[model samples]
Target: MTSRALLRFSSCESLNFPSTMQHAAVISCVFISSLLHTGQFALIETKETVWAAVGDQASLSCRLTEDKDVLQITWQKVLPNGEKNLATYTKKFGSRVSAGLEEKMDFQYESLQSCSMVIRKVMEEDEGCYRCLFNTYPNGALIGWTCLKLYVLPTELHGPFITISRSNSPPGSVVTCSATGRPVPMVTLTVLHQNLSFSHYNTSRVSNTNGTVTSTTTALLSALSSTQVECSVLVQTAAFRELLVTVPGLTDSSDGLDEDFESDDKDERWLVTVAMGLLVVFLCGAFGVLSMLWFKKKHQNR
Candidate 1:
């Protein structure tokens, strides 16, 4: 039927514009309504949201219902600013997919029935929303939107630097283990050899400038035995980093002895510097005295 007749029979209204413009709007609206009623003109059916991991592949697909005349299919990545066209498939022109970006996507089209796109090695930059558009004649465009949420898996979990040193806070030694990892890795200090374990440790967390996290866990050991200590760090159960440290007990006298040696070394350096200065002054004075005596003797002889 003609668009003007369809508008009238469907009771669709528009502004007092040109008959052509009004008819077009009413036709598009009425066509959408009829599609909803019969579920035919709505050709694109896809997932509302999709999730993937970094360095992994994601499958995005859509199938056409009874509507079989799909002229074009375009895939776009939506950002905060605007949408970026990733790839396009046309029945007449085949596919003119991009090489650099298109290498990441494996897009396949089955004429007017179905199409699928795979995102290879999905990255953090690929985490966003996507839009799939199907071009259909007479009815315009049918679209489906899906959000892609990516989990950036953690890597390189390193360093729970375990150190055993003397402390006077509780009149014993202090053991501090600090580590840094991405996605807030779990860090713990344990005595591996003796099966001594403690879960409570002082944690200092810092949000890094590069959108990562740094966690330093300090565990104070007071009067603990000399054993093999281990610093364990990981991102969930995915990655792990462990270091073994042989901890030795400390006495208060050892700390005092270290301080005393440092102080004595400084004092010796200072005394040497002062002694050299005094020797220079003494030599200058002796030279002056000899010059005066020689001058006086010369005057007396003259």
Candidate 2:
């Protein structure tokens, strides 16, 4: 072959080699790009709903599908008015200037591709929708949204009550016990006297129409001495909630010792009455014997 023709054929072969390889490479690139775009779109479309209680920690998470193109990911809070931004990622947006954002609010960025917003000491106002935005090259963008709900619960139960009063009898005692709590409570009262068994009393009442039931008890003790008396109030609420309160007993000084003194005086009076009656009988018998002896002597002299 001629040298010029050989050179031209070699050039043609070189051009064809590249042309054939270009189509395959372009097809492969298109397939990969399609897969990556689809995955990114899925990540943006599917978001999880997060819930947390007040005064607890919460996290908002977002991941990128195309790691190489991920430039920055941001998290922002959208206000209820829809026209203002409540808070924004401060690391990427300069220092945070939001009126409500405080130093305790934590914002964490991962490898410049993922974002996790950690909120400490969450409050009711913190409950709202949060947006996740991803910045990428080649006009690619991904956005995810999540909703957070915060709930506040009550901390503790209410109270148990006790009251005491005297009965109609002079120096007698009466006691009343009660307790109040959420969902109502069962109450029991126990009265204790020294050298005596415990006396128990119980009663219940439903004060509210919301099925809240309250219980009460009343008790009385007689002949009470200057002794320590104990009045106990036991309360039980729904779900085994329990509370106990004890009241010191009332001491009756006059009634307790006076009864014993009166009994002793009556026994002494009875003994004195019997002794006088026996003396009268003996005197009468002596007078009768003397009269009979005088009559017998008069008859003998006649």
TM, every model: 0.43, 0.36
User: Candidate 2 residues 129-199, lDDT tens each?
Assistant: 88777766765557677878765432333445666566555435555666554434555544344465334
**Per-residue CA lDDT of candidate 1, range 153-202, in tens?**
78545576777666666645456777766778777777665455433367
The residue-level lDDT of candidate 2 at 68 comes to 44
lDDT of 1 at 14: 44
How far residue 194's Cα lies from its native spot in candidate 2, in Å, is: 59
Q: Best by TM-score, which number?
A: 1
Candidate 1 displacement at residue 147 in angstroms: 1.6
Off by over 4 Å in 1: 1-43, 156-181, 185-204, 207-302
Candidate 1 residue pairs that clash: none
lDDT of each: 0.73, 0.59
